[model samples]
Target chain A: MLNYIWIGLILIGLFVAVGNDIIDEVQNPYRNGEPFVSTVLLKKAPSGIRQTWEGDLVAPPDYFNGFYGTQRTQEPIRQPAVISKSADGTASLTMNITDASPAWWREMAKSAGSKERLLGRVVEFSVSEDQTSARVQVVFESIRFVKLKAVTQAALDYAAIAVNIALGLIGIMALWLGMMKVAEEAGLLQVLTRILTPVTKRLFPDVPPDHPAVGAIIMNIAANMLGLSNAATPLGLKAMEELNKLNPKVGTATNAMVTFLAINTGGLILLPATAIAVRAAAGSSNPGIIIGTSIVGAGCATIAGIAASKLLQRLPRYKKAMEV
Target chain B: MGEFLKNLVEVISFIAIPLMFLLFLGWGLIKKVKVYEVFVEGAKDGFNVAIRIIPYLVAMLAAIGIFRASGAMELLITVLAPVTGLIGMPPETLPMALMRPLSGSGSLGIMTELMKVHGPDSLIGIMASTMYGSSETTFYVLAVYFGTVSIKNTRHAVPTGIIADVAGMLAAVWIVNLLFR
Candidate 1:
């Protein structure tokens, strides 16, 4: 299943990227080689014989929407731009895309070879009588294969991010592992495990309820319920290690491990802190309104996950996977 | 009642770690367990464990990142929308449900965007936030936890995770529509 899903993601991603690129190629939505005729309000006239100009690229909202074939922007375009003339008199326009730039241009600029700037050929430029405004027709740089470029970049970036996430875990993992070690050595874990044996005995009947794995599992679940994910992860990993100690087949998951994981993934938290915070940040009047709903959702997930894990472990295939 | 519950949990969250540290170490001290040496002995394995899971994490995350960046999720949403719409789920929040199990940050981004577009108290926003809270990032959890123990050929974990995620998402949509609609 994991093999199929992993490969499925990659295959689907690549196929969709190629498909979108093909559609973009046929559509030519970026209007490659087509001139964008607009007016520019100059900040100041170029001094002396130097043929460089800097100003605001102005376009009415209707014209901009019509040009882009969408109504993504409601306001007029007043993006800052610069047109530079070479010694031989050929001119080019460069617009640095900022937050003020229209969303379409930003999307185009991001897909451009440059990350946040749009480069274009300034085909025609004429100064107004007042020397404060000019008419310009620019052919913006072509954007192609945007999704493919992003997919390639994401593959590389996420690999590095994965390494960073693992490395970041070292400190917390060490802290919790060390504390749990001391607790284990002190015989503290057994006392807790004993108190919870009746409950865990049913959940993980294969393992002795008094085992240290039970202790770590309890700690992990408790921390998770409290929404302390930082603490929960190391503790969960510790539980896995202890559970693996009981695995007859080293590379295969045991029934107890699967059950424990089902509970972890259920994500039954007392308070969904991140969601509430985001709601509050989004100016919600009742950010806490979903607390009950989240609990209900997660509770169902937890119960369903445990039931599924228990039922699935009885299947012949999963049972065979446990064969040493 | 909700406010009280929220406050109580907030206070507990603040104090839980410090209290655990004190209690664990304090108990170890009274038991004459050589707490420092024992802790250092256990801490020695942390670096190895962290390094050991790099490959698995990279494989899982890169696949998900590619799926996200390719805009396949949007296409998936379009396909799944009508089917899900019949179940009382807003088509817009479908991304939240789908992304929830795949990537944590990605789902958060979707939830935030949904809230921005629709006020956070609206049905879509409520459903999206509930979806975010409903389930863990199952793939990530599986990768890190199983990676730690070098478990491959995950027999039923994937299906189990999918079942849980589906149930959670459905529950989220059901309850949100019931209460918020």
Candidate 2:
């Protein structure tokens, strides 16, 4: 299923890039003959050339809004490149705002209406000496696009991501899975199972009351609740394996498995410590403020997951397969 | 009120990580289980599962790279922005919404980028972080877990998972606006 989507993306991207005149033929480093690499500029499109000048605005410049249409209709804007400021006024600044789409670029160009409206408070606004034109020449540059080189580069970067993921998982997986083993051996699974029985039975009517899968599922959910992902995954796989043993239909997901998958994907977060850590590292004045919001949002997701899973099972397609 | 809630969560998390280990070990000893051997056995299983998932992870991640590199993601977001905007989603956070289900690292990267552009305390940053915290990497989880068991026909899992993801994204926008904005 995903294979088709992957191919479609590559093919469609190539087609679109060609049509949009974004596919640039570049010299292939490996080949001696011709330009083998086709680089497509996706997001970075130059709207137009602006008179580049350097000076402070008499006051903060009023942001233009036309390019951003409405909440739904707006195109994404690239973060403007910052110029290094000097104590003396000599830094170069470009008023041209390149956008993701050409339409937005045109909108930006049109929005730079009058000098009195835009540059009244600005100390300096002039065209750079490189160009003879005083008019703001709209130049479109597409920053985000897909090409063979980018696709290959992106694929190559995955190896590093894979290694990092594995490396990060090793210690956590060893520790958590080991402790989970201890929990199971210590009868904590049974304790947790009993505690979760009522809820699990309602969600998974197919499973028997005394099945070991109930315990495994409960423990998996518990680990997830604590943001113990290293443990949660192995435990989840373990639970799925146990559930598979009970499944009469091979290669097809049972109701219980689908429900579990949905719940796991819903992922109710209690602390969101990672996000908070990121906020703190990023210099947020109040890192923990997001925690309450996290709970509300995740709580809604989990409830939605449970409801969807349960309701989905009742549909004719799923209900018709019920084991007597 | 927000401060109190934050402190409460802080206290619980601080105490929980240690207590969890203590409870497991203590119970194992009390039950007279061979805790060390059982743990070793389970860790071996964990190692094997991790090895097994690498191929699935590669497949999923590679697809994500292609999709992202193609700029298909931005296209999708642009197409959906209007409808999403009506529901309170900011256009800036659209990429994260699209990426959250398919790839974890991808969404995290976008979240980090958004936080950098708009300060973490900004509305966009809070919304991105909230969405990040609430949703799971749906396709990644399904691929790895289903691969572990070799489930060929996922039946209704995909739609169900997507439903949850959409719900999470919407809730993130709503909750952040209410609490922070």
Candidate 3:
């Protein structure tokens, strides 16, 4: 029955991926380009307020004014600007000019009949004194401006659809299992009981090793640690069911299950794969830090969870359940 | 003292990462498939898991997007400025801290922005790196785990998980400070 549910979910996910075009949207490689000022260097520094690119001199263009119109060009080209070289011979150059003020930026916008304000801009050049004709690469590493809302909105809409489909598939599978009652008939309960026996004993030593509720608790934790929360639901429900099975009265919470849920919710320390994925997505040079942190952080949390549960169990109400 | 402990941790980490990967490889091989196949299967499982928890992931990602898009993250930076200042943490790292709980991708986006804003060697960038190392998606874990189990009442789970998250955050900050500062 579980196998069928798994197969069903796999099919549903495929259908959603195809039908909603979520796969395409997620894999979309569209990037936004907004207009912003960048610095470009010239063979000789312009005397007026103009942007310059920094780097080794490439072959001089026939005309600098052709690349940038006369309106964009500044006067009084600066020369041999202070070139600071690092130990590796990577030189940094800066251009000093007085006319390029915030007001000049505002006036430039006003002259262009545009309402948008101009942000600061700078040009960097790398000049190889030995190789006067070295190829110059004008790298634009930074830009500041607004983003188009339509593109972002479309991207998010596709993400929403994808998430909906995933939830729908998981929900359908959970309902099918609940309706069929395969959890009881297939002896999955017994399997879980056997699997969790030692784990329950080790994690919740205060509870009797042979307690009926231990199996359900362990199964739930295992499911969660594996990042199979949907699979964990039945185990949690079954654990609750078993806990109630032991309880003469229905609806009364058991100490063991509460502690179990607490620890499970606190989560088990297998690996922090989700965080690692995020780190990788974020473009971190190292995504492995999550592994160490997961061990230490989750390990600590598990200990704290156990300690808290034990401490809570010592209270009068919990003490009564422990006696059983 | 902290430096010694950190170096010790790094040395242990150098060994543990490879060991863990090898163990996974061994398990895959014992299952009678090539290691690459096993890895592919694992990756496929990850995709399935992502698909399964899409709603939760989306909500968290959207929240993070809103935080960034609406400039709430900037506000958070301002609010945390004094506190971070006292702790020797830079104001620029507040975005990364906020991103840690919501979406790993979102945090990474912020991390990239930070790396660009401040060079990789800057203290804030290093702390951001450490925070990325230390934290997990608390709500995503809850949603996936709880949703899987169909458990209704969160009870003590939320509090305990948050506490754990706080511990992870503090540990990352402390560890980075001790090592770098």
The sequence of per-residue lDDT tens digits that candidate 2 reaches over residues A1-324 is 344544665576555444332533242111112111111112222234432333222211122232222332332333232222234644332333444323433333332332112111122323444432221212222222225556666777775675556556566656767877888888887888887788888888989856778887887887787777766887788788779888888877888998898889988867787888888888999988777777877888878987898888778877665543
lDDT of each: 0.93, 0.68, 0.48
What is the DockQ of the complex in model 3? 0.14
Clashing pairs in 1: none
Q: What would the per-residue lDDT of candidate 2 be over residues B1-181, giving only the tens digit for each residue?
A: 7778767766876677688888888999999999899888777766665666676666667667766765667667778888877877789999988888978878889989999999999999999988899889998888778866777677777778888998988899998888767
Off by over 4 Å in 1: A48-50
Cα lDDT tens digits, model 1, A1-324, are 999999999999999999999998998888888899999999867788887899999999998878877786899889999998998888999999999999989999889979889999989999999889999999999899999999999999999999999999999999999999999999999999999988999999999888899999999999999999999999999999999999988988899988999999999999899999999999999898888999999999999999999999999999888888
Q: Over the stretch B1-181, how does candidate 3's per-residue lDDT look in tens digits?
A: 4345445544553465345335434544554545453333323333343354565445444444433443344545777778877766677777777667655567777776776676455566666766655555555555554443333344444555556556656666666676667
Q: Candidate 1 — what's its lDDT?
A: 0.93
Q: Model 2 RMSD to the real structure?
A: 11.7
What's chain A's TM-score in each predicted model? Answer: 0.98, 0.55, 0.41
Better candidate by TM-score, 2 or 3: 2
- The CA lDDT at A321 in model 2 is 56
Ranking by TM-score: 1, 2, 3
Best by DockQ: 1
Q: Is candidate 1 or candidate 2 better by lDDT?
A: 1
